[model samples]
Target: MSIQIGDTIPEVTLKHIHDGVRVIDTPTVFSGKNVVMFAVPGAFTPTCSEHHLPGFVARFDDFRSRGVDVVCIAVNDPFVLQAWGESVGVPPGLQMLADGNADFVRALGLEMDASAYGMGTRARRFALYAEDGVVRHLFVEAPGEFKVSSADNVLAHLD
Candidate 1:
């Protein structure tokens, strides 16, 4: 079964670019934090690049003021995630996490097969709000749909 509200985020190592490519486990990232993590199928794809990421970029402060840390994850390398964040002007402090091997998504049961599109294993578009590593809310988009997982939608529900 997929992870749900009240479930603890699974432990897995994920990569991100900071001073260098750093590998951090999920427990370390989510522990003691009010976190909003949103995942995309892949980086640089149209909807992901144009809409999904930008919405979070635009609302980064809204989340921060509420004492929440915002994260964006994709099944791409740390290098690509870094470059994409720079290209889109992602403000500092918004984490760009690389679920490079799809381990994290599979653990959450959110992995989707995009092989038909030649993208191989990918994450479904979804977002979750967690407090101290325990999920409080989850918003998963329907196939080919983008609505509930948007930054605005998540914040609305959070409030």
Candidate 2:
């Protein structure tokens, strides 16, 4: 089953590419924080690169002022995620996380099989507002759609 509001986000490990590959624990990072996490189909895809991730980067301040940490997740490797972050100039408070093994996305029941597109396993586009470790709101976009998971939509709910 997909994660729902009021559920505690499961503990999963994510990678952050920095001075080297760093392993980040999901529960440790999200616990005790008001978090806004959005997932994309893949790094550098047209829709994800052009609109989805950029929306969050552009609205970084909007989410910060409200005391929320915004993050982006993709099924790509950490190296690719790091390159994408640098290429896009991801601002502070907007994190770029790599679910390289698709473990976390699969746990949420949000995994997408994109082998037809030669993308292998990927994450469906989605976003969530979580308080501490419990999900307060969830938005999973329909396949090929990009409405609910956009930054504007997530920020509007925070207002």
Candidate 3:
């Protein structure tokens, strides 16, 4: 089963490009913060590049105003994530995280095999809200769909 409301976020190392591929842990990112994290199967894929990430980038301030930290995770390398973020104009506060090994997604039980597309294991498109590391809301999209996990949708559900 995937992570659910009221479950604590799993501890796993994730990467980002900040002065060169910095390492961060889930606990350090989610603890003591109201976080809104969205995951994409892979970076630079059409929907993720054009819609999913851009939606969050456009609404970064909205989330910040509501005291929520926005993060974008993809099962790609830190370099790809950094380039994608720059290409899409990701704001400073909205993190672009790299889950290169799918460890984080596996821990959440949200890993999906995309071997048919030659992508191997990747995260299902999902967005979750957490406060102090405990999940409050989770929006997981059906395969080949994009709706519930959109930034606007997630923001609407935020308190």
Candidate 4:
């Protein structure tokens, strides 16, 4: 079953590129913090690159002011994620987490098969509000749709 509101995030290791080095086994990066984690189907896709990420980037200050740390996730390798982040000018405080192997996506039960598009396994577009690693609110989009999980929507929820 897909993860729902009130579900505690599973403990999983996510890869990230930090200071030109590959970091592994990092834990509790978001623990004990108010977090807004949004997942996209893939990195560098049109919707994600153009709309989803930029929305979060634009609203970073607002989210931080509301006591929320924002992060974006995708089912791509760390290098690709890092390149994408740099290409789009990701802000310093916003993290782009890589679920490259889809372990984290599977754990959340939010994995989607997009092999028809040659995308292989990917994450369903969604946004979640978490406190201390437990979900407090969730907004998952229907396939091919992008409404409820937009930055604006998440912002309204934070209000």
Candidate 5:
């Protein structure tokens, strides 16, 4: 079954780009913290490039003002996310993590098959509000659609 409210954030090792590839320990990342995490199908895609990640970047401090950590994840490698972050000018502290192998996305039951597009498995567009590792809210979009998974929508759940 998919993750739900009250479910602990799953444990998975993800990657982040700093000077180089860095390990992101999922469990420790969420431990003792309130976190807002969003995922995209891939990095550098049109909608995600124009809307999703930028929304989070714009609202990064707002989420932090409310005492939450903001994170973005995609199926692309850490290198790709690194370039995307720099291109978008994502402010420091909003982590952009790589679920390159789809392990964490699949663990959340949020993986999608993009093999038809020659993209292999990717993460669906989704967002979640979590505290101390337990999910408080989740917004998962339908395939190829953008609705409740946007930063504005996820921020609404914070209220």
Candidate 6:
């Protein structure tokens, strides 16, 4: 079943790029913390590259002040995520985590097959407020839609 509000995140290792090296199995990175994790279809896609990521980057300070740590996840590799974060001007306090194997996505039951689009498996656009590793709020978007999971919407929920 899809992870809903009140569901705790599973213990799954996700990869990330740090100092030009690919680091793997970093599941406890968010442990014991209040985090806002949002997943996108893929990295460098139009909507995701332009609005979705920049929105979070722009409002990162607000999220931090609200005591919410923000992270962006995609099915791409860590290199792509790192480059994308640089290209999009990702701000401080926001992490670009790479769920390249889709383990975490499957754990959350948010995995989607984009094989028809030549993308293979990827994550749907959604945002979750996790307090100390347990979900407090979830905003999942309809297929091909980008409404509720927007940074503004998540901010409203934080308010």
Per-model TM-score on C-alpha atoms:
0.99, 0.98, 0.98, 0.95, 0.97, 0.95
Candidate 2: deviation at residue 36, Å?
0.3
Worst 10 residues of 1 by lDDT: 20-29
Higher-TM-score candidate among 2 and 6?
2
- Model 5 worst lDDT window (10 residues): 17-26
Instruction: Please give the lDDT score at residue 66 for candidate 5.
Output: 98
Output the lDDT of residue 55, model 5.
92
Candidate 2 TM-score to native? 0.98
Tell me how far the alpha carbon of residue 82 in candidate 2 is from the true structure, in angstroms, after superposition.
0.8
**Per-structure clash totals for the candidates:** 0, 0, 0, 0, 0, 0
lDDT tens digits, residue span 1-159, model 1: 899999999999999998999999998889999999999998899999999999999999999999999999999999999999999999999999999999999999999999999999999999999999999999999999999999999999899
TM-score of 3: 0.98
Candidate 5 has a TM-score of: 0.97
Candidate 1 vs candidate 2: the lDDT winner is 1
In terms of lDDT, the poorest run of 10 residues in model 3 is 88-97
Give lDDT tens digits, candidate 6, residues 1-159: 999887778888777777776564434656778888999999999999988999999889999998888999999998999899999999866889999899889999999999999999999999999887789999999999999999999999888
Each model's lDDT: 0.96, 0.92, 0.95, 0.89, 0.92, 0.88
Per-residue lDDT tens digits for candidate 5, residues 1-159, read 778888988899999977888997898789999999999998889999999999999988889999999999999999999999999999989899999999999999989999999999999899999999999999999888998999999998789
Question: Candidate 4 lDDT, tens digit per residue, 37-127?
Answer: 9999998999999999999998899999998999889999889988999988899989888988899989999999999999999999999
Q: After superposition, how far is residue 143 of candidate 1 from its true place, in Å?
A: 0.6
| Cα RMSD (angstroms) for every candidate in the order listed | 0.6, 0.8, 0.6, 1.3, 0.8, 1.3
lDDT per residue (tens digit) for residues 34-114 in model 3: 999999998989999999999998889999999999999989999999999999988888899999999999999999999
lDDT of 3 at 73: 94
In model 3, how many backbone clashes occur?
A: 0
Model 3 lDDT at residue 6: 99
For model 4 the local lDDT of residue 157 reads 91
